[model samples]
Target: MYTPPAFRIDDRQRLVATIRDAGLATLVTATVEGLMATPLPLLLDETEGPHGTLYGHLARANPQGRLPAIGGEALAMFSGPDAYVTPAFYATKQETGRVVPTWNYVAVHAYGTLELFDDPDRLLNLVRRLTERHEASRPMPWSVADAPEDFIRAQLRGIVGLRLQISRIEGKCKASQNRPAADREGVAAGLAASDRPADREMAALVAAAPP
Candidate 1:
């Protein structure tokens, strides 16, 4: 979260885009015992608050749900595309031999007051929305109504819903923005040539960053 001015991302639309595109987030909380975290898929209700509210669910058996978040807030970290940048990819390496290896990536952190709910009606609506969000891209979308009503109700009993009213959020994009124009182009080219999907995704980000 210690972001330099060059890497800080303050645009609200960009932050929301990153949060939506990043499929999973690491939800961390402080408890009397210690800090606990869970990787969860969350949905953002942009119209709910000043920033936004997060919605997700956890298994009832998970201790994270039962424990109280000691502080007023919890943290949710969403990590986006990332890739390793080799010195060989920098044009400065040949000019001055001053470049070193580094990483290029995007990350967004959200802080909010954590709230828990188990009301079946609310839980059912959340489940249905979450399902639709994830299934919209599929060739054949799935829905909560696809299964028996009794079976769905029984399944819902095993989980708890989460609501985090975001008080603060920060985004950082370290995508060769600090590098010289030539070096950034080299970095983008190198990453675009990689076989890894993440690397290629990072390449596009780098290419689009201000030179």
Candidate 2:
């Protein structure tokens, strides 16, 4: 996360919002063999610790979960809207023609200590909460109890739950913050006109950023 001063997102609320909206995140850990990462849809408990805590699970047989981590320190990466910014979209390109292509995006890095578990009860609770969280928007929401008790218990046995007590949180919004105001505006307008959904999302973020 080599973020320039201008592109740094210091707003805690905004960072949390970005992570929540992203829904899924990548969890990275330093292992004896190097780095290991897992893409997961983790639940965030904003009230859990200093910054917050992350909750998720891995398959019981997943070797990644058994590896020793760097004193439990792990990084969860949440990525938001992203768009490719072409030099042609910047107003500066029309003047000095010195602009180059770059990516405008939002991301959050949550550093924490990861605690893994194989407890059936806790894993069941985690799965229930995760299901409810995602299914809340549905007209007919599903529940963990929907399945047979024995089957549900069997399923829980095959997975391991994890809780990450977040210690540090860093957010970055590389949305043309370093560009001239006019250039930023032009990029936003260009992105808004693009067919890509991600571009349109980035356009709104750029427009909302302070000039």
Candidate 3:
């Protein structure tokens, strides 16, 4: 996360919000064998610590869960909206022809000590919370209680719980903040016209970026 001052996002609340919205994160760790990475849906318990605590689960069969930790830390990366920015999208390209293609994106990296737990109770609770978070917006929201107790218990046995006590966070939002106002406007407008949902989302972020 080599973020320039203009692209850095230091606000804790905003960073946490982005993480929550991302829903899924790439968990990276240095293992004795080599580097290991797992994509998992993580929930942030903002009230747990000064920064926050992350909770997730991995399939019991996933070898990453059994690896010997090389270092004391793990990295979780959350990616938000991102879009390709063509030079044609920069107004300055027409004026001075000095602008080049770039990318606009939002991302957050969380560093923490890896804590793996297999407690059934904790795993059940974590799964319930995760279910509720994702289901709340659905038309017919589902719950863990909707399933049979035995079935749920059996399913829990197949996964291992993950808890990461966040040590630090780095957030970057490269949303055309470094560009001139007119160029930024051009970027936003161009993105807004694209059919891709991510591009449309980035367009809004770009429009909101400070000059």
Candidate 4:
């Protein structure tokens, strides 16, 4: 991910949390036909591997599931809160007018060999878990049992399951940590005052990041 020393995140716990919080990832793989990427939500099993294992599915029509990963590995990229930082948010802007705009963001990259499966039972379980995870916050949560059995089976048949056992993971949090305390504070304050939810989330990360 070309992370500088100050931006590197080696803490597995934090990396896992970031992945979970992002809720979706872009899966990238090498193929004979070239590289293919799919933006999908993946369920992470932190207990499954040295890093973690990811589970998800895509339409049967997506060739990404059928193609062979030339390197026998794939990458899942997760992006967290991010905000644009303007030079006006820096103390240096007033002192020397030397600052430029930059972005404050959090991201994680996971690499692993992918394993595809079509077993109805496992796919059913995967969909159920994925559904529950996303619906837990709802006033009335829905379940796989809410649908007709035959219809659910038919739906599952049209998709293929993906499992990636993570071999390596990397995280980067570019949150204005390289800036001075005053500049960082200014940046955080600017982002926090913004109306966008993403900017507010990024403000918290920037405020909490150690310089």
CA lDDT of each candidate? 0.95, 0.91, 0.94, 0.93
Q: Which ten residues in a row have the lowest lDDT in candidate 1?
A: 64-73
For every model shown, what is its TM-score relative to the native structure?
0.97, 0.96, 0.97, 0.97
Estimate, for each residue in 35-84, the C-alpha lDDT of model 1 and write its tens digit. 99999999999999999999999999999999999976899999999999
lDDT of 2 at 150: 100
Q: Candidate 4 on 1-211: residue-level lDDT in tens?
A: 9999889998888998999899989999999999999999999988898887999998999999898888789999999998999999999999999988998889999999988999999999999999999999999999999999999999999999999999988899999999999999999999999999999998998899888
Q: What does the lDDT read for residue 151 in candidate 1?
A: 97
| Comparing 2 and 4 on TM-score, the stronger one | 4
Q: After superposition, how far is residue 126 of candidate 1 from its true place, in Å?
A: 0.5
> Can you tell me which runs of candidate 3 are displaced by over 4 Å?
none
What is candidate 3's lDDT per residue for 1-211, written digit by digit as tens? 8999999999998899999999899999998888999999999999887889999999999988888567779999999999999999888999999988899999999999989989999999999999999999999999999999999999999999999989999999999998999999999999999999999999999999887
lDDT of 3 at 70: 73
C-alpha-based local distance difference test score of model 1: 0.95
- Please provide the root mean square deviation of candidate 3 (C-alpha atoms, Å): 1.0
Off by over 4 Å in 2: none
Ranking by lDDT: 1, 3, 4, 2
